[model samples]
Target: MLATVIHAARDIRVEEVPDPELSGSGADAIVRVVAACVCGSDLWPYRGVTPTDAPHRIGHEFVGVVESVGADVEHVKTGDFVIAPFYVCDGTCVNCRNGVSTSCVQGSWWGGSDRSGGFADGGQGERVRVPLADGTLAVVPGPVGDDEIPGLLTLSDVMGTGHHAAVSAGVGPGDSVAVVGDGAVGLCAIIAAKRLGATTIIAMSRHADRQALAREFGATHIVEERGDEGVAAVQDLTGGIGADRVLECVGTKESMDQALRSARPGGMVGFVGVPNGGPELPVRQMFNRNVGVNGGVAPVRGYIDELMDDVRSGAIRPGRVFDLELPLSQAAEAYAGMDERRATKVLLRP
Candidate 1:
């Protein structure tokens, strides 16, 4: 099988790799990937912002059909369509029970070694060996059509992540909301804000295409300016008081500061962007206003079932963020398009 490997900065290649199989505990499963995509986080490594110690597999978000399951796996079986969250966790762990599955005691990630020291292939490949199979995989009732695959794939990461940001910020019915960043996750945040009944959604974006999509996804107002200008724009839309809840989807000092400043004195900021440049919280600023900040790496597994319902029912189309699609063999091109900002998100078919 062929899988994507990042050798170094700006170097991405698809090369033949070993096929995955069940592991010793019979707690693993092998999934034949139907679709996978590069994430904003993946770009950190691609752009050399995040150092690559050694060549390794890349990619995290994916959805596929179960090719096989281990002896202990019970919730799903062969041929079931499933969404694999970016992180692998034992569902019964204390952290998982508390709704923070990403912190599960036995949690691990794809494109890396499993807890047992065995290889776990990345999602951007022909197949993957899923750890904690029973706890990690969420079944998507099928027979699902090709048209629905992209939307379902979003449940693997971005859609669930966007939902986490909204939930953390305590976005409620009739509340005004602001979303920072206009990437796939940010656009999905707009969908989540609307789903949570936020009446006023302010999307901060300067790109024409993203701005159009933000409106389609439920952003009632668009603020093209950034920094102080952007914060002022959001405040003006909200009667000079700022948004009641702010969702920060970009992980940068600038974006974090913007999110914190764009909220009303009592508003909360929910952030999910993977930290690239260290972003600090000003104690005095947060104290002066009654503002609060909450959110971290999204525990997407916990939100999958609920979000999947909406995806299945066509209540939301978060997959619209995937504006580009290519074959698995063209993995290099997919990375380039995203790095160049030519595609909001790219989907790969194996």
Candidate 2:
């Protein structure tokens, strides 16, 4: 089997590796990964800012077909197409039951070694061994074709996170929202804000291409400024007040600060960017203005069912974020294209 291996910083390669050896029979399942992609979170280690002691397997978002399932795995069976949310959760745990699957007591990240189960080298590969199969894998309905792959794939992470951002920011009908950053997650956040009924969606994007996509996704205003200039621009658009809600998709201190300032004094800010060391916030500033902050890694498993219907019905098209696609063999290029900002998002097909 061919899989991605991160040998070092900026060095991602596709090479033949041993197939995943499924363990246990209670809930484990084997999936032939059909589609995978490079995520903004994956870039932390690739850039070496997150630090790595040894060669590590990368990637966590993927969708695939069930090849085999343990005896106890009944919800999904052979030939069922499923989307593997980034985390493997047992669903019965307290956190899972409460719709916070990311913190499931029996859950673990894709490549982590622990309880419920595990996947080898993560999702950017030809195959993966799913832990807690029944609870972790969401079965896609009916017969889905190639055209829907990208959309289905986003349910596993990106789109779900964007939805989380909007929900956390308290975006409601008639509310004016501002989205900071123009990355894939940021663009998806624009679509999500619209889906959630925000009357006016303002995307803070400097890139023409991304701004165009943002508008297409329902952004009513585009603020290409930065710093105080950016905040003033958003305020001007909202009638001398700031946005009612702000979604911060970039984890940098600058982006976070911008988001805090772009929101109305009592507004909320939902931040989902994987903070790679620079997400510090000034408590004094937050307290003085009453900017509410809430967000972390999204509990995608909790929102999959609702978002799936939206995708299946064509009401939302988050998959269009994948502007670049490559075969599994070109995984290195997939990483480079994303790292160089040459692609909004990169999808890999196996």
lDDT of 2 by residue, 258-282 (tens): 9999999899999898775766788
Q: Please, what is the whole-model Cα lDDT of each candidate in the order they appear?
A: 0.94, 0.89
Q: State model 1's lDDT.
A: 0.94
Over 4 Å off in model 2, which ranges? 116-120
Give each model a TM-score.
0.99, 0.97
Candidate 1 Cα outliers beyond 4 Å, as residue runs:
none
Candidate that would win on lDDT:
1
Which residue window of length 10 is worst by lDDT in model 2? Answer: 112-121
Alpha-carbon shift of residue 176 in model 2 (angstroms): 0.6
- TM-score top scorer: 1
Residue pairs with clashing backbones, model 2: none
Question: How many steric clashes does model 1 contain?
Answer: 0
lDDT of 1 by residue, 53-130 (tens): 999999999999999999988998999999999999999999999999999999999988889998889999999999
Model 2: residue 284 alpha-carbon error in angstroms: 1.9
